[model samples]
Target: PEIKSWIDTVLYDSACDSQPLKDKFRDQLGIALEASLNPRRKKTVTENLPKGMKKLTAYGNLVCNA
Candidate 1:
């Protein structure tokens, strides 16, 4: 009975200590999943061109006739 009580106490303490770590892991996973699903748009080279120079050919290549 004494050994059983000690084992129970140890297991309970371990579970309590693990709860915060589990929560942190879950939060990080959620952030990673959210970022993957809704990624931020990166700026393209052509996007920074002037209004008149912002032209793309039929094949989507930039045409700088200037």
Candidate 2:
């Protein structure tokens, strides 16, 4: 819980905040943000498609940039 709160504070912190605190939170915050921004879901295969398609499904994140 404390770590989550700390992450929130760091994420919302302004540029006016002291440099040391920013540095302290940088690594952990980066990990949290990356994990959250890139999300993955389970994909399923169905028989409705055309023949000769590979049936194996891979579980992975599908990242999209707009």
Candidate 3:
């Protein structure tokens, strides 16, 4: 029967090696998935830094803390 033949074909294809398909999928989506899963936050700069002597102390503290 045509239905039986189709089922057999489906089973045969499903049993065949699928590594190439998996590799292609990974190659296409790996970077995007990795970025989505482990996103990097951009470091923002302080726009309103202390103007004078406090600036040096602030900078020193920032550097030391980091």
lDDT leader: 2
Q: TM-score for all predictions?
A: 0.19, 0.22, 0.21
Clashing pairs in 2: none
Query: Model 3 segments beyond 4 Å from truth?
Result: 1-17, 31-66
lDDT of each: 0.41, 0.42, 0.34
What lDDT score is found at residue 14 in candidate 2? 39
TM-score of 1: 0.19
Error of 3 at 44 (Å): 56
| Candidate 3 local lDDT, residue 9 | 18
When sorted by TM-score, best at the front, the candidate numbers are: 2, 3, 1
| Model number with the top TM-score | 2
- Candidates 2 and 3, the one with greater TM-score: 2
Q: Which residue runs does candidate 1 get wrong by more than 4 Å?
A: 1-17, 31-66
1-66: candidate 2 lDDT, tens digit per residue: 356653553233233445555565565453222122112344545445455554434444233222
TM-score for candidate 2: 0.22
Tens digits of lDDT, candidate 1, 1-66: 334322321212232445555455345432111122111233335656666676654444676746
lDDT score for candidate 2 against the true structure: 0.42
Better of 1 and 3 by lDDT: 1
Ranking by lDDT: 2, 1, 3
